[model samples]
Target: MRKQILFLLALSLLCISFTFAQNNVQQRKIDSEFLNAVHYYENKDYDKALTGFDNVINNYPLNSKTTASYFFRIKILIGQKEFERAKDLTNYFIETYPSSRYIDEIRMLKVKLYVDDSEYFDALKEIAFLIDRTKSISYRIEAKTIGGQIAKSYLSSSDLLRLSNAFTGETVKPYLLLLLGKAFLKEGKKGDALNSFTRIIGSYPHSAEYFEAKSLIESPVSGEETSSGQALVGVLLPLKLNSAGEPTSNTAGEILDGIKYAVAKFNSGRTDKIGIVIRDTQNNEERIKQIRNEIGYNPNIKAIIGPIFSNEVRIAINDFDATGIPIISPTATDNDLTSESENFFQANPPLVIRGKIMAQYIFFVANKRLMAVLNSVDGYSPLLAATFVDEFSRLGGTIVTRQTYKSNSLSFAEQFANIAIADSVDGIYVPLAEKSDAPAILSQMVQDSMYVPLFGNQDWFFAKGFETSPELSNMLTFSSDFFIEFNSKDFQEFNNEFSNITGKDVNRNILYGYDTAKYLLTVMKNVDKNRTAIKTKMISGLTTRGYHNNISFDKHRMNRFLNIVRFKDGVFELIERFRSGSL
Candidate 1:
């Protein structure tokens, strides 16, 4: 009996040893698979890594490697752009392993995933949770940074103010303060915004938001004008005044009428006091001379408007050499003007900027590839045409032919004939300033049996040639600044007011006159009559929203918005509006 009992005991012990060995082997396999999966993930072979991780989780559900496998799986999902699934997995990991060391990492990953998907509001919520829960300083810093961005994105001035009042603490307060400043600036509260920017500069000098804060403090709006109690206004217009063949009979008279109208409004009755002055140039040569004289002699003229021609603007560059006086142009389309002159400002749409809008409409909206440019010798036309060519080329458009026409020439049949023969070309870009050029070109194109899409400049609206030419029916597209329809209420109101005031039909030129005047008058209200103050205010980035549209000068003092119009059935239809700043 004793021998049999001992044998049973030894057999039981062997069975227990076998069971322990099996568990040890299974655990070793799970650890090996988990390590290999991590190696694959590190090598960026996510598909293979995911396969290994899936095998470990599926076969060893209760193994010690499960937590790590879950974490890595979330990362792989994120790499695949499966943000929604990654978010769910992150949540699951946090809930299942609340005390896991990777919990902070999971929270951060969730926030990032939300940001990647542009779910800013949800990101904000996750950041708030992380800020409250995480103990890591680096993690908290990240959360604050993201929170600042989210607040800036969704919160307006009032909303920011409310948020600031609600959130308080060392970690959260600074970001909220920065957001508050941005909010105030967006609401046009200059004083409050300046104060907020100043606070950030003084206190958070080492913070990442410091640079932006410094920029706001150093902005033109926050400079000497704000402190000196002087309003800096800008009047931008092409002052060259003279055009080809017109000589003494130039656009200067129309520009002057606009200036006088603005001056009259300023000198009349208004709360804002302002000063106005004129800078005249015969063309490019006279423009440079006048600008130098104004900067050297006239310290009183705070703002200058004129130099209506593009070539003349190159001459006036000396005025922008840190004179601090802003030059606003009513009409100048050269794209390089803004980039060249820091103090230069414009009130009209630039051709380069407008060309982008035209390209977008033609290529993306119209879905056409082949194009032709019917270019003119006028200063603005060539620049605009070149811009269209460069932009369209970058967008994969094939230019079949670039046809050139002299501004004063009457013959264009050969140009149109070339385009008509190229049956592959899909569209035509015709930029002309003179009214007579378009109809003749279009007529020739029609006579040649060219039925391709046509695009034109703002001048098409006033072109009498179009009114008289049967080829007007061939105009498929064009761009303009303002239009007066027979039945529109805005047009009727503008016509009545303009006729009563100027005793003339409101033509395109007259609309320019009114808008220019309104812009100057609005700026003048905040300025002193002294020329220096006027010039200072005029160039100080003051924007004017007028009857025609909103007017703001770029760095070179050029207008930023132009309406793209189309001609159909003998009447003009509004197609799109291009703003220089937005593009």
Candidate 2:
């Protein structure tokens, strides 16, 4: 019995030793795999590193090595731009190992990844938690620095307020408040901005933003930055602000980005910089008058760039005309705006000239001598009709006949009858504001057999079927304020540069603002930095190439260049340009 007991105990001891030995080998393998993953990560071989980390994490979920494995795997995911998987794994690790040493580090890393993914709002929320909860000093500093950037450059005013309120400590709050104050100051909210600056000054004297706050408290109103080497230009935009002080129009914001990019690009490779003092015209008469009143003889503002509407230009000239400061509107089309104020320059051609441009094209480019006009009584059609009649006649071309019908009515027998009976009609000008009205007019013109050559306004670009029918495609010619050769190298370069500068894609709203700014800045760069000098250089036919077209304000103080597009072989082609100068 004694011998049997001893043998049994020895056998049990051997089994226990064997089980412990097997477990030790499995642990060593996991440790080796994890070290290799770290080795791969250190050498920047992320794909292999990802697989190694995955092996440890999947095989040893409850093991101590799995915590570090999760961390490395998430880092690899972020490197590969696998944001969703990284985010999910991050959450799982944090929840699984709530007290893990890498928790704070991984969460901090997530904020930057979110920003890179353009998920700013989510990044901001993560930052708020770090600012409030993290005990690590480095993590808190990183959060504050990134949060300040988002608050100052990316977030709207209301968003800034929400972010400001998210931070609690006096030390952290002042940094965000200063950024918010500076942003509000730019938007012309002196009182609202002062609240933040004053708080920083009064309560947080040793804070990082304290001195800047003190300087801001004593500084003059924003946009008075005409210090020694910088030139100032005033911008009046239809950027209506909501109750929360956020701009309601994305168009206005994009335009502002383009304008700022132009300023930055101009300042590059030169010592002199151009500064802009912007005001919100709100697209309202009262707002325009208020901005003008605020801009009284502040010798800093050298020239003005915009008041996007034609009637607004009429209102703006009431003040700018007296100051002798030039105002250029990028999109206004009223024919008489330039005449209202010699100081007012129209970057877009007036409606009267859209007609005159087409007339010149029909006579000179198409080599036609006689023309007939059929137009609607309402909208710009009549104005275009009258100008085409007068200019074609002035160019020694005969008007076969001119007729008008009620706008949007399909019946055109009276007008077509007069045009059909006319002798040697070289072309017909049908100016319709409604692109939908085009098909009916074309059908009637074809039915009445009055198709000689068709001339049209810019509105016809949206009308369909003109490019589809080879007969009409070859027959039609029209004039527009601008055209973009999209595949051109210069345009593509401009687009890439604009995206790099503004963090947004280029759109037409941005293009107009960009072209106008480029034109104005190119004009201002060489001349004396004074309103009189700027005005003289602008109106003296200083033509510069633009992203879409060229800009030049001639003797009439209006941009007279029009692009003539013709459809041929089932594609619209920019065939000619009508301007006083060579391209």
Candidate 3:
């Protein structure tokens, strides 16, 4: 009996030794496979990397290497923009590795997938889930930014009101005030806009959005009432210019819609039928010339609003300037546009001013000395980048590095990797216009555990992926000419009225149109019914405050006042105001 029991014990020990050896072999194989997969990923051969990662996941047990393999697969899938597959794999990872340290990362990727797919509502849900169920403060703050963005971009008046009511502390108070200020400005309630902006600036100076609030206070709104007058306001809008019979991408239909509303309001308030002669330029240069000729026939057309595109205005500026008809472009933002014609009044600030203001914010307000820049190769990025570098140096700040990337590149790994962000570096400036780029650079930074505050221009806020990625969303600080408090009583009123008029929500172009038209009506009504008189009035410090902006033409005829905003604890908090000629 003793011999038989000893034999059983010996057999059990042998079995346990064999199992432990087999497990060790499997782990070694997974480790080798994972390292090879990482090598493939490094070389940009996603297919082989994916295959190797898949092999590790399928052949190995739940260990660190296997856990890493799952995340690597997710990253590769996301890199491919195969978001649905990536999403499925992310879910599988969450379910399979519930206790993995990489879970927060996986959840963040899931949110990015949703944002990339334009599923903002779904992304919001995922963010809410992370905040509620997870202990990660970084993830929670990221959720706040996502919520603020959704509120900024898509929330209705009632929805914004509800959100405003729900989150009303210093943490979200600036955002709520901004939303309300925008809403008020949209509704033409300058007083309410002023109040909301004032509240943000006075109550929450340390809030990230305080800069924008201060700029809002400085937004020049001429409280001048419309006087009765007989003037022909020429409205040149590219209402439709596409080959498919749809409006072209560059058309100012929203601004045109706002002009219509302003015209209606003007006619209702006064006895004079201030004639609005509407012309569609098809956004074509030749058509713009034709429209100019048409305007020449109507000598009574004293003031013109629009010719929205800078290129379009370039085509017609000569004709209007030759005839002395002052053309106020509500959205033509080329820095040199005003230089082309003294008669041209730009409603939006030029990109050069935007760049200068951003540099000032970084150097003075944020108190950072050294910074790195990742600028896109095309669009307004290069120009903005040049302007910032020049201005930052002029302001006694140093650009540690400036890297450029093709706008169409799928990844900024090469860019971020090359940047040596030493302890002396204060912030990173990414002048990328697309939201896609924001996530690529930001995700790489997050994965590498590189925590640095980010600075940008307006494009960062409007980027598609910005609403989802918590790390990128939380670190952003930017500046722009437009900042609407979307939940203000004035905005609610404007939204209702505008929707009632056009059966649609108000857009930035629409607000530009409304403010421009209203300014034209107000200024023209009080001045002589002539182009010279209108130009003199506008150029001589004629200012009118809107929801969150001041619609004014400087002596150089460029728009004045831009809002500097920073993202912190989840909302783009106002930091300060950047006005023209102020370093």
Top candidate on lDDT is 2
In model 3, how many backbone clashes occur? 32
Against the true structure, candidate 3 reaches a TM-score of 0.54
Number of the top TM-score candidate: 2
For 1-583, candidate 3 gives per-residue lDDT tens digits of 9999999999999999999999888778878888999999999999999999988877656677877888888999889988889999998888877778888788889988988887765665565556545667566556655665665576544544555555545655566666667666655778877877788878888765565566456542222222233578888877785576555543376677788888898889677678898888777775665565455424467788888888888877864565578888888888788878888888888887788878877887789989998898888899889999999999899999899988767676677776754446678888876666766676667666667788888887766555456765677888877777676788889899889877998877778888888888887776677676788888777767675567776577877767877776666666655565553
Candidate 2 residues lying further than 4 Å off, grouped into runs, are 1-229, 242-246, 580-583
* Residues forming the 10-long window of minimal summed lDDT in candidate 2: 220-229
Q: Each prediction's TM-score against the native?
A: 0.46, 0.59, 0.54
TM-score of 2: 0.59
- Residue-level lDDT for 341 in candidate 3: 85
Which consecutive 10 residues in model 1 have the weakest lDDT in total? Answer: 220-229
List ranges where model 1 is wrong by over 4 Å: 1-253, 263-269, 278-301, 310-315, 332-336, 350-354, 364-367, 373-383, 396-425, 432-449, 458-475, 481-487, 498-510, 520-550, 553-557, 580-583
Q: lDDT per residue, candidate 2, 1-583, as tens digits? A: 9999999999999999999998899899999998998999999999989899889988764687888888888888888889899888877876777677787787777777788888777777677766666677667766766776666567766776787887778666777787778778777888989999899888888775676677567653473443343578888888887899777888877777778788888888887778898888888875675476456345567889898877787888864575678898888988778778888888888887878778777877788898888888888889999888888888889988888888667677777888878868878888887787777777777677665788888787787756334676578778877787777787788888777766777887887888899999999877788777788898788888876567887678878688888766766677766773321
TM-score order of candidates, best first? 2, 3, 1
